[model samples]
Target: MNQINNLVRHTRLLEIVGDLIRVRALGVAFGDLAMIENIDGDQSLAKVVNLDRDIVSLQVFAGGKGLSTDAKVIFLGRALDVVYSDNILGRIFRGSGEAIDGGPELPTDPRIPVGGPTVNPVMRVMPSRMIETKVPMIDLFNCLVESQKIPIFSVAGEPFNQLLARIGFQANADVVVFGGMGLIFDDYHFFRTAFENHGVFHRTVMFVNQASDPLVERMLVPDMALAVAEKMAVEGKKRVLVLLTDMTAYADAMKELGVAQELIPAVRGYMGDLYTQLASRYEKACDFKGAGSVTILSVTTMPGDDVTHPVPDNTGYITEGQFYLHNGFIDPFGSLSRLKQHVVGKATREDHSQIMNAMIRFYSGAVEAQKKQAMAFELSPFDEKLLKFGRLFKERFMDIDVSLPVIEALDLCWLTLSECFDPKELLMKQNLIDKYFPKSAHSEAEEGETVAQVA
Candidate 1:
């Protein structure tokens, strides 16, 4: 009971105007944590809405459900803080930063405010270093550069969750923080075991808001996860990766709140401030002035695979790049990381850019070849070569199971190119071909008369 009292305190009431409860107080800060208490025979959850001139407003989290005008509101007198320490690694927490796995409560520390301002532009270092996940499709082509904000735009039932898990397992980061909003029970369990099984849980912290949890709580997970991530990066933890899944849920929660508040609706029944809300989170990925960086890789699932969905449409404007996950794979043609150019050849090998471009160009041709074949069009000899290259590309490079470092993936690209066509047909610089082309291609060329014959 003492703990409960410490968490909730009384202050002089400034005014109670309609649903708004205003109070004069001290030690109340913006985003400072507060909890609802049953007073005047009321039972409901409440959220902190406004803190001004040491006065705080407690907006009922449960929509003032079962709460009378005289209900007691308690201020914790401290900002919302997440438990941050080495002990947080390998732990699963609810949206409120409470342990849901029946583990001991995290030790208290100085409260850290959530949803802090974005890093200043002058302080942000230009992103150059690559954060390798060793996923062939991602590392080889759509590289995850440091401090880049990219989204995995996928549809439901696709392997976006698995892909995120794989990246979390393979990322060479000092720490990984995962925030799941409105995830189902299966996805929550899958992330838990995937980290545990892969031995990466030792450096991972997860804040999950499941679909069964209170809807209001779903909106808090990102702020919680990003706050911890910012702290870790500021402490010089290099390569801090923040993974958020299903931000669409978070947006929907915002829309629900807007409707409850009777605000005017924006496009698609979303709030007018949807873009600002998303940018606040996405812009949190920054390379600090003197500290380590925070890289954000989030999943934004499209409704009915519609790219024009409000969530993804607004996301596309704010994020640096996107990985399009389709039909259980990262679509090579559709997925893109705009920051890849910053690191592809400069941070990686000289052939990194060349190979990525050539492979995708060839794959695009293969797509056209596939269309031609489907239509029963007469295939040119070159078109036939494209068909063969496409099939091999899908089998060797596009498949999610094929994992390799960026360099090794580039090597496989050369091998694939060599196996399908002659050096001249590849349209690559003669110098690069002489340097990186597989020896098998030269030997096969000695036996074969032409590129067409090889295909």
Candidate 2:
């Protein structure tokens, strides 16, 4: 309340629908924060969401409740910014960047502008470093590369939020920044407790928007999360991994606004510019050339688990790749990380590619064998072998609960393969088979161990 309204204040309301307010104003820029003062001297915050000649439309962050047409509106003269500091780590903030955990305000002036321009391509370095999450489905199969933008595609009942929490603790990054939109109190508490119990809260910052918050603020969570991450990577010189959950909710927020504006619907009732709106946030993923990097891992839940849903469909176009979560596991055949080859063989072991291919091939074979059995066909010796390999693969590697370093998992992979078939049955190089086939090896642990050790 002590903050000064150091600019001209307008007392007019062109329209008031939902949380949006349109007023007569001049020289108001997009994304600028505005203060709406009620007749009772109570103030609420809003952000300039649109502008047309002399009329500026603002999204009231605190919702458009108890305001009159005569309420005073003051523009803050600058784009929306979230306070930046190392002190934000381990703290929980609301969608508007206010600390919601009863913590003291993070001190001022270096505010990071939300939804800033994407880092220039000329300044970006090729994303080559692998970001290991100690999850076999990720580090071992489709490796997550530093500065990569990827999403977890899952249905509503799937445990995607749990997977995000696992990555928060297991990902090899200097800091973790989480943005949760439209989450219920239980989901919010789950993330907090998981991070705290895992002892990674000290290096994480959470920006959350609960389901009961106004839809407009839900739209700001990604921007706030990314802005804070940009500050941390560029200024603090840290490798930052940003995790956003349920981007489908964010898209729904935009769709609500579009409906309120009486705009024609595009794909599945989403805005026609949905792709552009999503790309603006996802393209923010950057390697930052020489300073540091900002990597993104987000969840995009599909309606009815349909990949054709507009949100996940558009997301696939902007992100590098996606992880498909199904049946309590990241489906190995469905998930992909496009940048994995940049480091899988170069940064990882020489046999990394061979081992990866062989396991999937064997798993695919196992699936076929199970199908044959379903049809009541007589099983052959080779079919039985594949059936056994398939079962072990899911148990040892595909389960989300299975957490092991890349090398440790690889060693176990060889153990799994060896237990299933003869050396020639693997169809691997005889030289590699001779050198690394567990029995002739000095120690299987030492072989797979050094490949991804530095990741």
Candidate 3:
């Protein structure tokens, strides 16, 4: 180890394999960022991935291509840090915190370190508030509670990214931090354009690692997004929503690096610490004691639509719940929000809990009715009603394009139920039915009139 401006520098490389390098250097800490300058004057960045006594192993950000054995490596004695300020909002940055939006260069003041520990348990408050996303299925059924960490589990070819962008713009929060890993140019452009066109770009910050970028940057996107979100929630007293797309990519990046470092592979070639790495990011969602909150809603694409896949399997144990996305709709039966109990009837309308339950119960019955009809069983009059209700349910509430506030969604739930079943058939509390059930205007005469009008 040689000292240049009090920073540790090593001028020899013992090994260079697939973007990984080993050097005999002292005083190097894990996760420390170092500058790797080759003799050709081309410089790149690397991070200390492993440290064993006097030997340090780093993963070069720009890859170890055409590199000599004696490149100068300078350890910065600090972990990866991202620039943070009010100007960071509404800006687009790469996973490495570099501005790629052709905007003016931002000052490097108040750079905050990424990949920090989770918030203290004592400093976290119980999540009791709701994040209204104006999506009927999410807002009315699976309420997105503040400070809740959840994922939208889906597979490829689904509109999960579009759904994510909708929530990013429509969600009720003081700020939105979006982290996109392994996105193509089209998907990246879609998110930016969606936020801009929907008038949320002013308060949205995006950290993107495109498919063509270095694999190491994919793992940095979440850490950068979460770090900025935590800073805003704790220090700026702003409610922040962090949206990460395709956590599978992040996990795959870890597996690739693990293989490069010759570490023992866990299940499916992933590193053994996949769960810990995921929990560290998801746990960033917390409501500060006296400050604002950080709520995380990420997308985890299951390979081959297998929930048993290690990424989603581990995530299921770590997150509060998941919104299962399939066939371009948020599957009501497959989706859940475990933290919704804290806010269902408390922060929302009194009829929320009742409406949610009755709708789902009836929908389940409707599905069974369809199955019975398909198998050539005799259909009862009630089964006919269920069939009608099922169609209206999918058309009105389940569609991803349908956007309604929580209150309006609750009212619509009542209308949809009334169109098919009598108030007594709802099986809800009598008092709730008395207060919210449709009156004579939605009764037989009006129902006949509605049919006539449609006819």
246-352 per-residue lDDT for model 1 (tens digits): 89989998887666555699898999999999999999999887889999999999999999999999999999879998887789878888888899789999988
| Best by the lDDT measure | 3
**Model 1, residue pairs in steric clash:** 32-79, 33-80, 45-61, 46-61
Query: In candidate 3, which residue ranges exceed 4 Å CA deviation?
Result: 1-8, 441-455
Ranking by TM-score: 3, 2, 1
Clash count for each candidate, listed in order shown: 4, 0, 0
Residue range 35-148, candidate 2, lDDT tens digits: 889888888888887788898888887777888888889887877778887778889989887889998876764677788788889978898898889999898889999899
Give a tens-digit lDDT track for model 3, residues 112-211: 8898789889999989999999999999889899999999999999999999999989999999999999999999999999999999999999999999
Q: Which stretches of candidate 2 lie over 4 Å from their true place?
A: 1-3, 440-455
Give per-model CA RMSD.
3.8, 5.8, 3.5
Candidate 3 contains a number of clashing pairs equal to: 0
Worst 10 residues of 1 by lDDT: 60-69
TM-score of each: 0.89, 0.94, 0.95
Task: Using lDDT as the measure, name the better of candidate 1 and candidate 3.
Answer: 3
Pairs with backbone N, CA or C atoms under 3 Å apart (clashes), candidate 2: none
lDDT of 2 at 222: 96
* lDDT, residue 138, candidate 2: 92
